[model samples]
Target: MVFEKIVEILRNYKEEPELEVTMTSSFEELELDSLDTVELVMEIEEAFDTSIEMDGTLLTIGDVVGLIEKAIA
Candidate 1:
């Protein structure tokens, strides 16, 4: 469920349904800037009913995926 949400968020931002949502995909390739990252984090938090600290550590799509998986777990 979390994975699908991540993919959906990426797809919504990219406006492309064909993009792959793999662990190694870079957020930059999806046209996600710092503001987008913040918004994504907020959305994920709302979806998961949890708060996530947006440290400077999340640098890629994989990082976001990993964080979501960890939060859900």
Candidate 2:
């Protein structure tokens, strides 16, 4: 469910018409920059009513999703 939600968030900012979102999709392919990532993290925190302490290693969309899922679980 988190992955699906993440995909929806990605779709909101999808700049390229050809980009496809799936569970296996990479974050780099979404063209998300640092600001985007921060915004996304904030959105996720609000949506889930939780806080996520992220490190610099969350460089990809999938990594963020994975972290979210882990936090939720």
Candidate 3:
């Protein structure tokens, strides 16, 4: 579920080069700008029906997935 939601967010920016998302993928590799990150955070909160106070600690796709799971749990 977490992976799916994250991929869905990434798909919104599919006009860019194709990216192969993986647990180790970084946001830099995906080329998500600040606005995109904000939208992603908002979409994630809406999708999971929870608030995520994002910090710089999350640095990879796995980190995001873990954070989302932890928040929803």
Candidate 4:
């Protein structure tokens, strides 16, 4: 459920509608810059209703999913 929501948020930033996304996909690979990352994080926080400490360590979709899982646990 979390992954699906994350993907939906990400799809807004993607140019290609058919682009493939997976847990291992990096923000860089997704063409999301630092600003985009910040925005994405904000959107995720709003959608999930939880705070996420923005950091340089988060690199992949799976990383974010894990954080959300932990945050709502």
On TM-score, the leading prediction is 4
Q: Which wins on TM-score, candidate 1 or candidate 2?
A: 1
- Please write out the lDDT profile of model 1 over residues 1-73, one tens digit for every residue: 6778878877776688888777776667767788888887787777777775588888877787787778778
Question: Lowest-lDDT window of 10 residues in candidate 1?
Answer: 22-31
Candidate 4: residue 20 Cα off by (Å): 1.2
lDDT of 2 by residue, 4-61 (tens): 7766666665644455776555556667777777887788777777777866877666
Cα displacement (Å) at residue 72, model 4: 0.7
Whole-model Cα lDDT per candidate? 0.76, 0.71, 0.75, 0.89
TM-scores of all predicted structures: 0.77, 0.72, 0.78, 0.90
The clash numbers for all candidates, in the given order, read 0, 0, 0, 0
Candidate achieving higher TM-score, 2 or 3: 3
Residue-level lDDT tens digits of model 3 in 1-73:
8887777776765553355788888777778766667777778778788877677876677877888889988
- Pairs that clash in candidate 3: none
Compute the lDDT for candidate 3. Answer: 0.75
Q: In model 3, which runs have C-alpha deviations exceeding 4 angstroms? A: 15-19
Candidate 2 has an lDDT of 0.71
Judge candidate 4 at residue 22 and give its lDDT.
99
Model 2 clash pairs? Answer: none
Worst 10 residues of 3 by lDDT: 10-19
- The predicted structure with the larger lDDT, 1 or 2, is 1
* Model 2 weakest lDDT span, ten residues long: 10-19
Clashing pairs in 1: none
